[model samples]
Target: MLNEEKSTEAVSFDTEMSVEKAKDAKKTLKRLIKLLFNQKQKIIIVLFFAVVSLVFTMTAPLIFSKAINVIYEGIKNVSLSGVFNIKFDVIKELSLLLIAIYLLSSLSNFIQQHVMAAVAQTLVLNIRKDISEKLSRIPLKYYDTHKKGEILSKISNDLEKVSDTLQSGMMQFITAVLTIIGSVILMFSINWILTLIAFLTIILGVAATSIIGKKSIKYFTNRQESLGRFNGQIEEYFTGQMIIKTFNMEEEATKTVETSNSKLYSDEKKAQFITFAINPLIRLMNQIGYVLVAALGAIFVIQGRLSIGLIQAFFQYVDQASEPLTEAAYILNSLQAAIASLERVFEILDEEEETPDAANYKTISNPKGNISFEDVKFGYGKELILTGIDLEVKAGQKVAIVGPTGAGKTTLINLLMRFYELNGGKIKIDGIDITKLKRGHLRSLFGMVLQDSWLFDGSIKDNISYSREASTTSEAHQAAKLASADYFIRTLPHGYDTVINDENSSISQGQKQLLCIARAILANPCILILDEATSSVDTRTELEIQNAMDNLMRGRTSFIIAHRLSTIKNADKILVMDKGNIVEQGSHDELLAKNGLYSDIYNSQFARSITAKAL
Candidate 1:
């Protein structure tokens, strides 16, 4: 008994140490408990049925033992047919009672499992929905720093792990604990000495489990991280498969995948080996305990200090008591894996979301295209991308921004769209500070077309009409015609009805850009931001796109970020930037006559084109 107490204390200490080392595991467990607590009513119902089922299950062995005792006594004191018939009648009654109890126990178990499954699924659904909503609210910086594949793995794989654990592990854990307590009580009632003996031996098994479980936890955590890395690599490789093939780096990509896979295998193997080791050691201890109990019970029976029924009951109770301990090995492993997954999920949930609007925020119901950046300053982290800027544009004017790569060209557009908050200064539209306006309302005033054209799996009409909630076929056709995409689109088998599952698979890059431009044309915002809008097309296609853009920019304030100086030669004003500052701003002719940075860039491009034509 003293050994058993000390052993329990050791296990407790080990558990505390493991938890201390794994702060994330502890936090995740607490969060999961909080989530479960929200389903109190369902949990209470499950517990009720589980307890009832456990009672019926535990009591059956006692009744069976009693029946055995009765049979033994009857056979030993056989007198005649009259005695035998009376004993038989009593045994028959006990058997019927046992059968009824077993049926009730099974029914209770069924109900408990049914209710738990429902609760688990509901919890999973809500979690997934919350994650989806969270993705929208989180800052764009989060996506920039994190991989899409890793985030997706947490949403799908991690949540599935949590769901599986909640469904089976919760009920199993509750039942195991109840069974251990019930079995212990019955064992003591039969014989306190044997009960003590059983406990002392089981404590050894528990101690082994605690030690092994502690060592395996780190490996389990590593396995989950490796899985995330592996998934991320797969996503990157698949998305950039064309680049890899072009560079002939297929072997290198395979090597990268294999490295991640090998790491996962190593961690998984360690965790599983340690977990599987516990069961056999426990089984060995259990067999040893059975031998001790039988030998002691037999001696006690010879001295008439123990009854045959109790000896039989003790045998059954010994098995029942140790069963939970053996199953604990498996349960602990599953829970560790689930907790690891939960930590990843909670990490995302705990991230700082995008800044929300203040109380009494302004709304932009009818916005004019006038925009101003007053001494604006911004950065990624601590390094400033745009040091300082002051710019103003009137409605219906075309402004061009040109700079070398990484001169904060894209960063300017990002700030305008409110994808990233400015570190300092203010951006205003029509004399109202945009910082005071609701982001959704502010964004609705502008339309954008980028170099990379994005279209999801949908029909051509659906993709073109995506900007409007309801657009007629004729409206879509007009938008496509304006962008010069109608000719090729109509050449397809189904015309506007043709589905575009893979944008690059069927359509050329230029055609994809045309479709994007048509979508933007359909949106028809008061302001337009075009980033390398015609860079993907050939010269002929570029001319068509420029003509279409000219029509689209008729009365809209437009900001064009372009590398090809020829494309923006007719802009109302061109802002030449270098090192995050606008070096010069003027008409193309004025800048050219000035012979400044813009002139140099334009002259170089002209020289290159002339040289190519001569060749």
Candidate 2:
């Protein structure tokens, strides 16, 4: 008895959860509809067509009903010249009216479908643009956490589903409701008793739809989630294909993909099965309703309570009623799927964006790049990466930040660029608080070269001039020469016009870095940031790059983050960072004499280069 009670309790808990979920689903559906219809001005054209289609659909059964009554009346009273005259020439007139009704219905349906298609396309285009704009405003951390494939799924698959709902499902749903309403009124006019029976069948169908629809919605949500995961896994695997081969982990990679694929397939199948069941079940119930209506109508006619014409019209009304219920079942399933997609899209759009502070400050006309960080504290989250990093760099002074891996050197650069806000203290440039300056104007003053050199799929010339506007060919060539990239660039078959594919092409990593340097040089910013700029180059290439860097840093205040100590040995000041704190700061000679963290790192790096040369 206790076990039975426990089971009952568990079932009751599940029931309550299911009810809550259903309520949430309804809310989500309503929200999605509101979003779709909010662009009322743009959607009015499509709505007009939808309304016309619905009216025509509703009138189709009525036309047939009227024709049946007219024909019955004509047959009841035959016309034979002087012998007899038909009360009304109902057959001839009804035939002509039926033809006109069908023609009008066809024309309206054609126009409605065309308008709906146009509306769906337009809405999809606008939605994609809106998503893209929203993504641009979102913080970088959001992209860092999300997978590329998952984002793509939202823009592609989810948007496609929304389009499907708009183009077909929405129209079907409207027409179905109108048809149901029309059929019900006509049925009541024919026989109230049969109308009551029809109502019971409809209610039963609705109940079944509700039960199956809940399961369908749950499964569809799961299916979309699984698809996103599957896409993410596939993207990750392909991105790391080289690593998998080097590690001899092909089988492991395959297994991982297989597992993800299996989960996706299972979820999809389950959702499809549940959604598919709705229409068939509704159709079965509809067929039963049809049979009951026909039998009862025949009985009424035989009892002399109903005319033959009235029975025929009643049968037509039953079929019309059943059609809408059948369509409603299908449309409800489709609508549930669309809601799943819309929810995912909205999830991204609703994410918090980076908020810039409300402060307008004087624009730096000729920024001298005098940077100061006073007791700065920052971190990714709870773990503090930078603590009390007090530092200053005079105008045009070359500052080098040297640190062990994960010692918050890059975090400092990120803070300077305002990519992440500092938890404590202030960063100022030219005696003005950076937080008060517009990010766009502030970033425009800095030329940054990251450890990983990124090149878009475009011509070399295009890559070199990827700033605000296209650079002149002569200007691009000059920048390339300053970066020591012009020599190899000219040797290529297409030279500056040679197209490079995404992170691919026969070019070496050193060449890619040089190209990136050229890009930064073309921008001609007052402040330059070189982060492991020559880390991938050989000794000869490094010397060439060092010369290029010397030319680039001639008139600019530069911040160099280098693992190679020799490159920054001549810096005006060297700051040694350890666990988010500036433990030591001095010139190269001064730091060497102090024999601290900076000295140790410099010696280790210099000795390694010497040993490599000896070997």
Best by lDDT: 1
Candidate 1: where are CA atoms >4 Å away? Answer: 1-22, 80-86, 502-504
Clashing pairs in 2: 385-580
**For candidate 2, what is the lDDT?**
0.79
User: Number of the top candidate by TM-score?
Assistant: 1
What are the lDDT scores of the predictions, listed in order?
A: 0.84, 0.79
lDDT of 2 by residue, 1-615 (tens): 001011121122210012123326666677766766766654676557656665665566666666666666666666655333333566577667777767787787777677767767777787788889898777765665578878888788888998989888887787777778877887898789989888778889989987887778778887787787777778888888889999999999899889878988998998888877777887888778778878987888879888776777777777777878878887888888888888788778889877755465557888999999999987655656676888889888999988887677777888888876778999999998888888788899899887788899999999999863667999999999998899999999999999995567589888998898899999998999888888877889889889888888887899999887888888888889886688899899999999999888878877887898999
User: Please, what are the lDDT tens digits per residue for candidate 1 over residues 1-615?
Assistant: 001011121122210112234446777888888988889899999999999998998899889988988888877886765565238887999999999999999999999999999888998898888888898888877776577777888898988988998899878878887888889898998899988889888889878877877667677777777777778889989999999999999999999899889987997798788778788999999889888988999999999988898898888888888998788767877888888888878878889988887668887777778899999998765667578899999999999999776666777878888888888989999888887988888888888888778888999999999887588989999999999999999999999999896535888888888998999899889999898999999999999889989988988999999999999998998999887788899999999999999988898999999999999
Clashing pairs in 1: none
Error of 2 at 587 (Å): 2.1
Model 2 TM-score relative to the real fold: 0.90
